[model samples]
Target: MYDFTTFVQSIGNFLHGQFSPGVATALEWTLVILIYLALYAILGLVLVYVERRVCAFFQLRLGPNRVGWAGTAQTVADALKLLLKEPVTVNKADKLLFNLAPFIITLAALTVISLVPFAKGLQAFDINIGLLFIVAVSSLGVVGILLAGWSSNNKYALIGAMRSGAQIVSYELSVGLSLLTMVLLTGTLQLSAIIETQANGWWIFKGHVPAVIAFFLYLTASIAEINRGPFDLPEAESELTAGFHTEYSGLKFAFFFLAEFVNMFTVAAIATTVFLGGWMPFHIGDWAGFNAVMDFLPPIFWFFLKVSAVIFLMMWFKWTFPRLRIDQLLKLEWKYLMPLNLMNLVFTAILVYLGWHG
Candidate 1:
């Protein structure tokens, strides 16, 4: 794999050569931290704006066009508004936890961004247990949601949080199984290895039927896990009245909002890396001309294009489908998705064992 982070770090070391080794290392880390922060800010804002525009398009309405050119800065205006607004505290709420929940969730979402390989060499943290770290860190937002609901002293909030917890916990199994399908095929847990294995062809193309099934399963489970509309019981406003973050206001609310938006990107990035081939260009066998055409574009462009495709699919689900009832939601996962996941995992394992995988 190309090492973009190392290149940047080396530049930092060279620039700070007069300083001690420890100081230069610290400076290198600081540069990396700033890059991540910029990514969080830019990507978070872009997702929100794009989602709104997509929803408006689906609804046959003109989206935000007044704030800036086609309302590109609408989310930025909203963020500033949130920043200027005062945070209100609920007297009956658990003060400490209430204040802590937003930051915790936001931090959880931000942490996973470091592990995703955006391009050939543009990864921040490339640990051996990369996939496990993603799964474990991705699940941390649930704790913040649970705490927010509990601290709010609001029945609606509590119910929403519990629903979110149940939903994420159940769907996580399907998501994991879907990912495991690829892991079994590739015989590796490292995300970079997974991507490289698909260099000749994406897993969806290579694994055929079972991989296709797992892809869809991962798609559906990811949407539900993130609590987006159609699976958004956690924030079912008609029922839960704003859900777990109901009592949160101002900057605190902004934090939760940022976490949710960024989480969507995080999920989409995972999908791109796992199924579509992270930073890998489309290559067709024995089609030299076509392969060269595909390779002409930069790797980052290919990566973003794939991520956007997945994100758009997620947005399509959010806008087109009706929110599922809690019972129906649980049933869909357990009775349908879970069964399919188990069968698919077994089938994939069998395929690998028989040496039939392409």
Candidate 2:
């Protein structure tokens, strides 16, 4: 396998040898930030195109097939329009937090993406407590949403914000618990170590029913957490107008919109790392030829393949299901997902203790 880490290390070494340590460090960090920014922007555009085309496929429509080869440039064009529009401020809005809110959510999305392990040496932040870090940082986006609503001084916006706050807070429990189930099997908080443990087989295959339950639990909670359809009470068009970001327009609105797709990607990437084996390719036992073929693809290829699969599943849920009432959404999480997740965790722990999970 190609060692991307070594290649990156070699670049860093060359930079250090060419300049003072502080300058080299600063330059390296600048390069990293640039790369992440490019990725963040590119993913936002690409994902928007993907979602449109995918939903169109489901609805039997043409989607974005006109602009720049199958509507590839459609999102870019829309982004430009939003950028060129005038940002209208609410007459009575709190200027400070209202302006700050978009950055808060956008920052949260960008920060969480840094923790994901894209390939063997592709991760930016490989912290010891990466899972905990992700949960904590990702939750911060709600605070921004709440602030956006309250600072806007709009009733509909406030309502949307409150709904989002409640939804994310409640569903986060299920997210943590579902990931914790696999933590027991892997016994590590590091993302890379978790992937390494799955080199033989993914937890979904090895941990049996409990792991499967946890995967679905995570999937369901994550959809709600990101405020997708079915659980998107915060921005339900029939009820709340534009929801938490109703007062936002122009670039501010674009920031909020971009953060959403980025957050979706972050959630899917985390799911890939935790439950779908991250960058590891699928391998059947005692099938060297088949395994070798799977291994022929790069780790990054496998990683994004799994992530794309998960993202498509999320989009399917959005297009297929009807939106849930707020009460029903909360009930589904607190009553069903939460309890089932707890039981699955207990069962997984028992299996791990008995050495029967394999």
Q: Which lDDT tens digits does candidate 2 get at residues 102-157?
A: 99999999999999999998888899899989989999999889999999999999
lDDT of 1 by residue, 177-217 (tens): 88888788888888788888998899889987998999899
RMSD vs true structure, all candidates: 1.6, 0.9
Task: Report clashes for each candidate as comma-separated counts.
Answer: 0, 0
lDDT accuracy of residue 86 in candidate 1: 90
TM-score of each: 0.96, 0.98
Cα-based lDDT for every prediction: 0.89, 0.92
Overall local distance difference test of candidate 1: 0.89
Model 2 weakest 10-residue run by lDDT: 228-237
lDDT at residue 332 of model 2 (Cα atoms): 95
